[model samples]
Target chain A: MFYRTSGQFKTSYTADMALFPVRQDAILLAIILAFAWVILPLTASEFAFQTLLIPILIYSLAAMGLNILTGYAGQLSLGTAAFMGVGAYACYKLVTIMPWMNPVVAILLSGVFSAGVGVAFGIPSLRIKGFYLAIATLAAQFFLVWLFEKWAWLYNYNASGAIQVPTLQMFGVTVAGPTASSHVQYYVVLGIVSLMTILCINLTRGTLGRTWKATRDMDIAAELIGINLMKSKLTAFAISSYIVGVSGALFVFMWRGAAEPNLFDIPLSFRILFIAIIGGLGSILGNYLGAILIVGLPVILNTLPETFGIPISSATVEHLNIMIVGALIVFFLIIEPHGLARLWALIREKLVIWPFPH
Target chain B: MDFLNSLLVQPFADMFAAPDFLMQVLWEGLVSGILYALIALGFVLIFRSSRIFNFAQGIMVVFAALTLVGFHEMGVPAWISVILSLGVMFVLAVSIERVVLRPLVGQPDIILFMATIGITLFLIGFGELIFGGENKIMITEELGIPTGEFIFEPFGGFLLLEQKDVTAVVVAAVLVIALLAFLNKTRMGRAIRALGDDHQAALSVGISLQTIWVLVWFIAGIIALVTGIAWGARAGVSFALEVIAYKALPVLMLGGLESITGAIIGGLMIGLFEKLFEIYWGQPLLGGNTETWFAFVLALFVLLFRPQGLFGERIIERV
Candidate 1:
């Protein structure tokens, strides 16, 4: 069997500690990379790239950012959309102000602004815990959205009060704005997502991740053991915000193309939280799996009735879609509160011992 | 100097200059405060019994009102529609208890909270699919609630009070008193309080959790209907009313989650203060929509000082 580990043996501690301890995982990653990098872009249509691929990558990246704080660091934030808004608005201002700057650099740099804002809001987490802290984040959510609406300067005093992405070239290649092709945008999103995903995997597997798990499990005990609680929590916020901010920039510039302040409301935050929770919080791969399901489920449902030659209004389909998603959340939670990642792990376990009942 | 005066002195000066307008604002605040207390009371009852935050409480209001209006639209009499809506809510409570909450017993608090949000989304879709998303006018006149205005002349100044608001306050007060008596005097109410204190012990004492849960949720549903009618009367029934749920959260934070008295006092304080701040200070200095975050910000400040909230039981964590 492809997943069998019978012949593979780790001879050293380093070998055992390597990211893909099982040889099959590394090979699986290579195959996935091949599809993402080579096969999909070359074969898929513009609709597929726009509606599925690009959005999935961007959302996965955002969920990964949230997973760090809520999943790893034992902090709950319901204001992720506001942080994303900070990133998007910051990127918008950066490019508009410094038109000569590299678009990629502008997007990456936008995370710092969101990081600062994230830390400011995260201060309440030090004094509050659990749902109380979550509500504190809502204060940021509402206030920031209000700021986006009232502060004319954020949107450059645009007549419509929406941020419009302007055409920008990177090394003579159109990568963002209306003129950018879906293929180009998809690649940019894929590239940034992969880079961030690798960084997150490493950070989460290292010392900082261990510290976070300790803090999350029991902060008082973690403190007794000489862990610097403040440093751990704040660093979690800063890094989480940075990644989330970058994804926000990517969300707007690479995918949505235009956004209003209302776009970053509570519902958006809940969507991202859903991805984190449903995908299996604290797992890097879970973000992608979660994003795929959350983003792709509706699209598939929208087309299924048509493919079957059934007559259903689009509005009815939309309503059904919402109902199905809500039902699925409850179903998933009842069945596996740990999320789809755990489900995958179980399948992989069974696959490893397929021939034998044990 | 002028900026300082406008920020600090002028608002207070203006209040004294037109005492009648200030009185009207206070009256408006008290009415809204009472409504907020009603919503908070529903939350307190359910949280006390089940420890579920019930994020769906807001959507329940929308769904109940929609059901009432939908029934009337189908040619049912207004009073019958109200009764039928209560029946629908009862069915919803039983189904939710059986399908959702039963399997989720002993789950982490956040998981249960997430489940309620799931219920919220499901109801939104279900309600919209059945009744359509358009706003519907409340059957205020059909329900026999007066819609007239009362004008009071005092200090040689005119004060205006909407009769419906007066009706809302009186009805809410009566409902609260009735709810309090039911909880204190009834056997089932004591069972609910016992479950809130210690679920395992209550179960050991032969308390049927499923029955109590159904009852508690049914009561919450009834309260949701009243809130729906009162709020819908003010601003026609729509999914947009769901946003008011967020307003009750700060009240929960200020009052302890399990304390009914805390919920009522906290709700009134928030309702009154947020409006007062918005009119007197927020509009002039902060550009007016401060009502949005005012409650949350105040709650956060309160939480910083008293982490358990002003009325919540002390949190004792064990490692």
Candidate 2:
């Protein structure tokens, strides 16, 4: 079988512990990165780069962040969009107040701000579990959105009550804002997304990750075994929020270039949750897969009908898109609740067996 | 006495000073509460039987209302349209049971919940496709529901009450009583309670899961219809109604997901309290739109105090 890993051998622990242990995987990743950097910029239109690629990268980052807390830690959070809003607003304020500061640092600091808020909201998890915790998180969603709406200072008292992203430059090269080249913005987002993905993979494979899994699988047993519930849970929240916060910064600063409180409302939160579910919870690769399906499918639906000359109205297409996504979610849950990641894994397994019967 | 009356008691004093106004506000809150209770009832029925949170209940309300209006727009008689809408809801319930629920029988609670979200999205799309995605006025008068008003003069001031408001409250009360009786007296009702209590045990006792699911879903559909009509009569039938349906989420949180009585009590309390707060404090301090989130904040506090809610059975976790 072309997919067989039988010949793969590791001579050292470092090799075994590499992010992609298989040489084929490493090569495939390199090719993917090369294609993204060299080919996509040359071929992709401005709309494709801005709408399709940028948003997917941003949401994948957010979904990965959520994967750490809700997927790995077994917490149900409905405040993801709120946390992202915090990051976006915080970054906006930071960049405005200190024009000399680097934009990347501003983005990281914004994540720290979201982490603080995440811990405060996550405290309720100590007392509640399951749906109760989900409701508690909703409080954070409503409260944060309300605070942003009423607190004029957050938006710098813009007459329209929306935050506009200023042009971002690093080393005199425009990195963000309307004037920034699509290729520059794409590289910036791609760079951040890649780093975050590496960090998430490292964190999830470490001792802290084990503690999370332990807590998720059995909290009482975890406690007996010396895992501090508060510490582990809060840490998960902090890291998760930090990742999501960065995504928010990128979403507004790089993708949308403007933001309003309603832009990060409950529907956005639900959409991210759907992305996580359809992608496969807990799997790192599943985040990207889920984002592509959930975010990309509508675009595909719109284009495919046109290509076929079906003459569907845009409104009807939008409706049918929603129905198909809904039907797919139900179908996925019924057939493979583990998500598309599981389906891919199954295909790989079958390929490994080749022509031989099991 | 003047200071106390102005600060502490004037709000109620003002209400009584114009008895008609007090009656008007109270009637408005009551009618709104009944509609909220109807939506909450749909949610409670599904949760009671399946233990799955039906996020689509609000969409179902919109869908039912849209179907009725869509039928009317097609030259169907109002009475026939009502029957057709009911039939559509029945078909919806049966298809959902067969296609969505049956396949997802043994899934985790969260997955089932997510599937309902899928159902919600599908219904939203389907509703818009069929009904043309525009607001439609409720045919209240044509449906033989009164649109007359009653005026009361108290303390030399007049209060106006719509006859529709009166009808809504009375109908809701009768529906609640009928539901309570059905739940307590019927064989199917017993089976539903048993299923909610323990699925495996109910299966052991020979309850058909499919039949019970269909019946509960039918009941929920009926509740959705009633809610759609009542709410549509107030705000017109449109997707915007989905936002009002979200008002029921806070009610469910305060009432507990599994309790019908809690849904009723919580709906009324939130309805009355949010209106009162918006009028008295919200307008004065926060510029009045606080009604949007005041009930949710209240529910959040209630959850902090009593996670099981007023009528919910206490949950005991093992290990």
TM-score of each: 0.98, 0.95
Positional deviation of A202 in candidate 1, in angstroms?
A: 1.1
Q: Please give the CA lDDT of all the candidate structures.
A: 0.91, 0.86
Candidate 1 TM-score over all chains jointly: 0.98
Error of 1 at B112 (Å): 1.3
lDDT of 2 by residue, A146-219 (tens): 88898899999889999999988998998877898878888888989999998998889999999999988888
TM (chain A), candidate 2: 0.96
What is the Å distance of residue B203 in model 2 from its true position?
A: 0.7
Q: Interface Cα RMSD for all candidates?
A: 1.0, 1.5
Tens-place lDDT digits, model 2, residues B1-319: 8755555676766656666666667667777877888898888889989988888999999999899888898999998999999999999999999999998888877888899989998888887887778889998987999999988776677777788888888888999999999999999888999999999999998999999998899889988888888888888999878987778888888898899999999999888888877776666556557866787788877887787777777878678
Q: Which stretches of candidate 2 lie over 4 Å from their true place?
A: A10-18, B1-23
lDDT of 1 at A268: 87
Shift in Å, residue A17, candidate 1 = 1.5
In terms of lDDT, which candidate is strongest? 1
